[model samples]
Target: MKHTISALVKNRPGVLAESSTAFHNNSINITSISCGETENMEVSRMVICAEGSDEDIAKVTKDLQAMDFVIKLDDLARKEFVDRELVLIKVDVNKDSMSQIMQIFEVFRADVVGMGQKTITVELSGDQERVEGLIKILHPFGIKSMCRTGMIALKRGDE
Candidate 1:
């Protein structure tokens, strides 16, 4: 099963490394992770996605919550939340293919952020499904390079 764990930690150096090391030592496979400062500048929130059995997830959660820097922890996988990811992809292009690629980009609502002699770079942000859909559709165009920001999520409703 996949699990999303959110942790609030003090805004200090090495916190991210420590947290990741804990997960590594526990044998958790992190598929995605993102962190940024919270409303309180003194603290930061980390959203992490990992795959493991329920028992394994529970153990890691417990261990993470016990860390000195972790002020709070939430198992977002079990809650209703909104998640998103951002990706930038560069695809090979030519006069003949440029128009076709632009049409496809319009269909996906992706923006052409850069253009080079033989390639066009696109930037897209949305849920995992939407991003994956665009990538699948553009595969035939030949992807030169791509980069993705891992999933970031927040709970729904008033918390």
Candidate 2:
């Protein structure tokens, strides 16, 4: 099963590396990861996806908390949450086809974040399935390139 863990770690050099190295040593494959500094002191929020059982996740969380840099560890599986990922797609465009593609973008509420002579980059942020649905909708149009952020989530309700 895929497990999502949210970790609060001290924003110090090599902390992330050490934590990831531990997972690597355990033969756990990290499918997605996102990290960013939060406002409270030098702390970072890390979201990691790995294939592990409940017992394995428990062990991982326990091991991580032993590290000095770790502040708190949360297993998102136990919470009600909302998650999203941002996607940027650059699509091939021509003068005649640009207007048609723009209409499609309007339908999906995608924003044109960047534009080049022959391409337009659209940004979409939503649930995983909705994001992929937009991608499928745009597939009829040629895509030059695409980029996606790993999933980020926040638990619902007051903590």
Q: Pick the candidate with the highest lDDT.
A: 1
| Lowest-sum lDDT 10-residue window in model 1 | 58-67
Candidate 2 ranges beyond 4 A from true positions: 53-55, 95-97
How many residue pairs clash in model 1? 0
Error of 2 at 50 (Å): 2.4
Top model by TM-score, which number?
1
- Give the per-residue lDDT digits (tens) of candidate 2, residues 1-159: 888888889999998899998787667788889899788768989989888777777777788989999888888878888988889999999999989999988988999999999899999999878889988977888878998877788888876
- The backbone clash count of each candidate, in order, is 0, 0
